[model samples]
Target: MILAIDAGNSRVKWGWHDGADWASIATVPLIEFAASSDHINPFSITHGDPERIVIANVAGEGAHQLLVNWTSIFDAEPLWLHGEAERCGVRSRYDRPEQLGPDRWAALVAARAVHTGPCLVVNAGTATTIDMLSGDGVFLGGAISPGIDLMRFVLHEHTGRLPLQEGSYRDAPRNTLDAIETGCRHAQAGAVERMHRAMGGNPLCIVSGGAARSLLELLRLPSRYIENLVLDGLARIALSERAVTR
Candidate 1:
């Protein structure tokens, strides 16, 4: 059995897979994590113990410790995943490969598994990251920009007058709130579209992260959504290591 965890900026997603299929999968907002990690169990209270646990953490130290705290009760220590030069057929193009976010790297690995051809990997969450991958599994680096929520948040935080809450996305917004939201969506969608165009051929756009659904309808390129690809890549990495060791 293998456990995979993706600790993103705003939430934490986890799943446990037993070779053939996932035994369990769940997500918890970071707001609830302090209590969940410290008091209640974050992974699984029922599953005996995971043979291997792989994690991709981009939230920060607190999240790093949460995994640490969970693995304390088990015999196996969690393998904290970081971006590398190459792994599982995907090679990175980042100038400083390790500097690339782990979440992004995991998504690239997942892209390699899901899309055999070139792909534009888009993860729209606290921050939206769009990365390009060549057909042969070379991770041609991409871009990062403010997500829909982050765009709204910055407007609310930096400026005066704008409300802190987000409004609905509109084609032609009637009011201020909707206008802000609509503009934000356009930017998010535009980034994906631009990346797809840059890839120059019709490439599969494998989308994930919290805002994936919102961006799905707006994107012009062929797209598919995987709930949390970071988790999928974690599972891939774990299985690869198991095969090597065996």
Candidate 2:
């Protein structure tokens, strides 16, 4: 068994897979653990003694220590993943391959594992990232923007009059709430579409993350949503490492 963990800006998502398929998947609200004093075992969401525990943590030092403290109970010491020039059939074309976010790197690896053709990888969570992966397995760089909620929060935070509230999408928003929602959704979808166009080939857009459903409705391109993509990629990396060592 392999336990794959993706600690992002807002949440820590994990899954258990037995090489063939996923046994279970769950999320731990990262915000809840603001301090080490607020102890919550995120791993208790499911019971599994995984042979390997692989993680891609972009949540910073505090979260890292927390995870280490929790996962220490398991026999498998965590295998932390970092951005690399090449791994699991994906080559980085970024100016500084090591500086690329591990979440993005893992996503690219997972995209390559599932799709053979060119791809536009989009992960829309606290921030929306649109990455390009060539048919030949190259990480061709991409773009990042504030996610839907962050967009709304920024407006409310930076501007005094703009209120942060829920709203539905409309072709022409007549109210403030609708306008905010519509504009943010369009911005996310537009970034995805623009990256797809820039990639040129008839690439498949592999979308993931919390806000993906909203973008899915707005995007008119060839796109499909994959839940826990980072986790899947972490698992793939783990399996690859095991094979290499053997």
Candidate 3:
């Protein structure tokens, strides 16, 4: 079995694969992931005894240390994914490949595997990332901006008037709570539209991450939402690496 973990700024997503298919999936708060004792029990779940573990973590604080400690409990060496020139059927076009975020790289790999033709992968999480992949598999650079929660956080933190607002999952804003929600929604929607236009009109857009559904509801363009894309990408990477070694 392969264990795939995506440790982002806000959440930790995990998936278990048994060589044939993804057997189970779960998510937890980022801060709670390392402290959760339940994860240490290999036989506690259906997919028992993960042979390999892969992780894509963007949080720089105690995240790495915690991940290393947690994986050590299972006597597994967790593979920390990083941006590279080429890996898992996707290549980085950045001048300094190492500078690219692992989250984005993993998304690219997963996007190429699941979708055909040119694609724009929009990850709306702690930080919104828009990445473009060419029809022929070339990875073109995209954009990044403050995500929904970040925007709301900034509004409350930096200003005295704007209250800390919770994200609304609904489509239309009706009241004050909805207004703040809609603001964040439009903020993301506008960016997506701009990127879509810059990429030469329409492309197959794939939205993922915590804020994916909210952004999708606000946007006018056609899109498909896939949760745990980073974990899926990690799974793909593990499988690809195994094939190479064989």
Candidate 4:
């Protein structure tokens, strides 16, 4: 079996895949992994001794060492994804390819595997990122902005009047809560609409991550929601590399 881990700023997600299909998946507070190893067993969580473990972590505050230690429980070497011009099944066009986030790369890889046309992948998490992939599989650059949570956090942190609140997609905000929700939704929707315009109106927009559904509900343009695309991408990369080695 293979295990794929995506360690983000607010949460950590893990997926397990047998040779033919994904068997299990789950998400937990990032703090769980920071706990003592005796508190939870990595091998027990996956229910298998993972042959290979791949991680795409953007929240790099001792997480690398923590993962390294956890994977050692299975005696498996950890493969940390790094940005590259090309790797697995996707190519990057970032001016400095190394600067591209591994999570973004993984999402792009999954987008290409699922759709064979020009695509705009929007990942809404700690930071919202929109990445474009041409029909021929060339990764054109896209955009990045604060995620819904971050935007709300900034408003509360920067101002005394605004309180930190949850974000949602609502057509009409009748009250103050609704007003905040509307603002966040509008910000996300506006960014997506701009990308749609840039793509010339005929590209597949694939939204993923925790906030995908809400963003899709607010946006007027067409889009598809894909959950756990990063894990799928990691699985694809691991399987492809495994086949090549054979």
Best by lDDT: 2
lDDT of 3 by residue, 57-141 (tens): 8987687777776677665677889888987667778888888898899999999988877889999999999998888777888
In model 4, the number of clashes is 0
| Backbone clashes, candidate 1 | 0
Comparing 1 and 4 by TM-score, which wins?
Answer: 1
Candidate lDDT (C-alpha), each:
0.88, 0.89, 0.82, 0.83
Against the true structure, whose TM-score is highest? 1
What stretches of model 2 exceed 4 Å from their correct place?
A: 33-40, 44-48
**Candidate 1, residue 67: lDDT:** 78
Return the TM-score for each candidate structure.
Answer: 0.96, 0.95, 0.90, 0.93
lDDT of 2 by residue, 112-222 (tens): 999989999999999999999999999989998999999999999999799999899999999999999999998999888888888896899999999999889999998
lDDT for 220 (candidate 2): 92
Q: Tell me, what's the RMSD of every candidate?
A: 1.2, 1.6, 2.6, 1.7
Quickly count the clashes in candidate 3.
0
> Which ranking of candidates, highest lDDT first?
2, 1, 4, 3
Q: How much does candidate 2 score in TM-score?
A: 0.95
**Candidates 1 and 3, the one with greater TM-score:** 1
Model with the higher lDDT, candidate 2 or 4: 2
Indicate the residue-level lDDT of 159 in model 2. 97
